[model samples]
Target: MAVTDVTYTRHSAEAAAGLMDELCTVYADAYGQVAGEDTTVKADAFRDRATGALSARNYELVTARADGELVGFVFGYSLRQERDWFAGLDPAPEAGFTDERGGERTVVLAEIEVRKAWQGQGVGRSLHDTFLGGRLEERATLSANPDATATHALYEGWGWQRVGTKPGRPGAYYREYAVFVRRLPLLDRR
Candidate 1:
């Protein structure tokens, strides 16, 4: 389907709640097999966090709907002193990062998911492309389960490079998932 045919737009706080649930449902379904023991709990926490982020305006939630039905979405925000999208940890004291890039250098992209039924239909790619094109960042980063080969391939196929990996929690045998980064050209000035 044409990208324009799929309506992509920013969602308001009220609309975000329902969209967040759909996002979490898709997330749990995607990661449940890999996440043990606390799948629902963790997914619910993620949903709550997404909601909070939206409510605080820290993150922008963009949803894609085809024929008026939500099919895919992305959530992210401008990087601040205390908020880093991927790691969720404060940057190192000596990291030399700042959120004051005059609206130019935003580190974002916490999560992007497309419903299973919509996979391989260019929906995910459409969302990714739209997000990158819409943001002002020089680069975007994301962490993906290393064992999620398909996901990795998708990123790589889109010209994202694998930067590094981090260890997984105990009992999660799939340790050290890969981190991907993609440098994007500045959005059009016009």
Candidate 2:
């Protein structure tokens, strides 16, 4: 369905906390239980992760609402020089590629979720562009499930390049993801 009434809003971490319930609802709906994976449990994990990272430096949450209903959102944070976001990267990227100095080199795209009903109508791409377009970092990075072919294609189409692979978290057992990166100042692709 084409939604021409969508409105995009950028929220600070503090403001995002107030919309946690709404954000999680969209996330849960976007990723309904698959292979016995309960979305409630997954949503809780997402809540914990998102909550903890909300205070990270330069955190931003961009939300999309259609006719007053939340439909999608994207959130990310700048990477600190003292931390290595690609610590577990397999076949590490070329030397200096992953280096972060003064938290300006890279922005880690933590999550992007769109309601199932809003999947096609340009919501995901719009959210992605809006989020990255506002970043001041040199580049942005995100990891996609290796099995999500369509999602990967969407990112690639939006000018992201797969740099390498990163192993999933300890107990997830979902294998690895293709880490993608895109230079900053994204072109007006909308």
Candidate 3:
């Protein structure tokens, strides 16, 4: 099932909220295939996070569709000093590394998903690139389930570096995640 004619669209937080149901459906479809995860539980957590993200300043979302069906999406927002995305990072980076300094330094790659059938046909890459390409922030960061080998590989291949590990948010999932960072403007994404 190759999605040869997929279209990617960018949406602001408000616009994305209007299509929340469709976005969650695609998220659930993508989450359903992850090994060692409780699909229902994770999906619920994602919905909660997505809703909160909608209110974050500078929120941005990019969705990929093929044949009128949502197949994938990637979204995140500017990280402010108050956000504390790295609050629980084990063996935290040196001082000043995690500082957002009023949200001018880093943007987060909060979530990226591609339906199972569209997993490897460039849909994920397209959504990722489309979402991050326009970010004016100096860097970007994301966390992935360490066991998701293919996903980790994809991020590394796209110029992301494994920084450290962090435990999932207490109310989200009970697991450790590998943190990754990438410089912005994504110069190497070819």
Model 3 lDDT, residue 160, Cα: 96
Which 10 consecutive residues of model 1 have the lowest summed lDDT?
85-94
> In lDDT terms, how accurate is model 2?
0.86
Write model 2 residue lDDT over 96-164, tens digit each, in one string. Answer: 876787777899998999999888889988998899888888899988888888888888899999877
Score residue 87 of candidate 3 by CA lDDT. 76
Runs with alpha carbons beyond 4 Å of true place in candidate 3 = 1-4, 33-38, 186-190
| lDDT of each residue in 1-190, candidate 1, tens digit only | 5656788887656677766667777766545454347676677677766766774434567878888767788877665544433342222222533343554465567678777667778878888887777776677777777778887887899989876665554554355557676887976664
Model 3 agreement with the true structure over 1-190: per-residue lDDT tens digits: 5656998898999899998888889989886767876787877778888999998878999999888989999999988888777877877798888988778788899999888788878888888888888888889999888788888898999989988888876665547888899998645432
* Model 2 worst lDDT window (10 residues): 181-190
Candidate 3 clash pair list: none
Candidate whose TM-score is highest = 2
On lDDT, the leading prediction is 2
lDDT of each: 0.68, 0.86, 0.85
Compare candidates 1 and 2 on TM-score and give the better one.
Answer: 2
Q: Assess the local accuracy of residue 174 in candidate 2 as a C-alpha lDDT between 0 and 100.
A: 65
Model 1 residue 9 CA deviation (Å) reads 1.5
Root-mean-square deviation (CA) per prediction? 4.6, 3.1, 3.4
Worst 10 residues of 3 by lDDT: 181-190
